[model samples]
Target: MPQTEHGANRRRGRDETEEERADRMWTDLIQEVRVAQTGVQILFGFLLTVVFTPKYAELSDTDQTIYIVTVVLGACATGALIGPVSLHRLVSGRRIKAQAVRWASRLTLLGLLLLLATTSAALLLILRVATHDGFVPYLVAGVVAWFLLCWFGLPLWTRHRHTVK
Candidate 1:
């Protein structure tokens, strides 16, 4: 059985060689990336169109700056999320699938973090534009908190709580 090393005499995972595991991980990572990529791409596409709308000129300079920053963050997130696919394509048949998988995993993680930031920024900007209220920041903060708990906090907690020893 191909088992992952955990501590002494504590093997984990399936009976698969390193290459098989890498292939499986790569497939899993790509599927996960696809979901995130669609969202970021759609959001980025909408954001790009916003600049052309007549209402864009009506935005305060501060809001304009926020919009600009959000767009940039969205662009970066899109790039990171798509990076793993590019990396995989370029490294194909290099006899380095394990290294490729590791790098791809890192890229996917970085992409998720960037997606979190991009979403938060987009929410902040949209709320500010919609409400123009002093409490918009607080509202955005609350939503951000929810996102953090749902997206990151809960996952980490589950990993820590459920992973076998």
Candidate 2:
């Protein structure tokens, strides 16, 4: 690319400074996190209520253990998903928006990973209890594969294909 008068603008197609770029990225990141956080919180809320239900007491020992683990994963996912808001509250005026945004992005990614695990485990437990069929594991595996492909594979492939060197 030939050097334009606005050299940086020529490359990025935006005539924005570092702080401006950070602000824009932060806004976009927060919006994305908001959607993920809402879903995780709702799921976690449901997980909390499961143990209090009558059906919970009838669960097999293995299923109960799975329930316990799923709840823990849900809690972790909730915490990770909410971490960025707390991070913003504390670090808002620190003049390190770029660093804060990086940390927030990492937390969001971890939250998504935890959310995936929680969802898969919850699905496995539900299927085992509802069907008692030998194919429950296979069904859960297929769903998990779909989630992985939608959540990670496509985004990564697009990033690899489109990102400027």
Specify the highest-TM-score model's number: 2
Which 10-residue span in candidate 1 carries the lowest summed lDDT? 1-10
Off by over 4 Å in 1: 1-12
Number of the top candidate by lDDT?
2
Instruction: Name the TM-score of candidate 1.
Output: 0.90
| Decoy 2 TM-score against native | 0.92
> On residues 4-75, what C-alpha lDDT tens digit does candidate 1 reach at each position?
465346445689999999999999989999999999999999999999999999999998998999899889
**Every model's Cα RMSD, please?**
4.5, 3.2
lDDT of 2 by residue, 1-165 (tens): 546776643454579999998999899999999999999999999999999999999999999999999999999999998999999999999899999999999999999999999999999999999999899999999999999999999999999998777
Q: Which pairs clash inside model 2? A: none
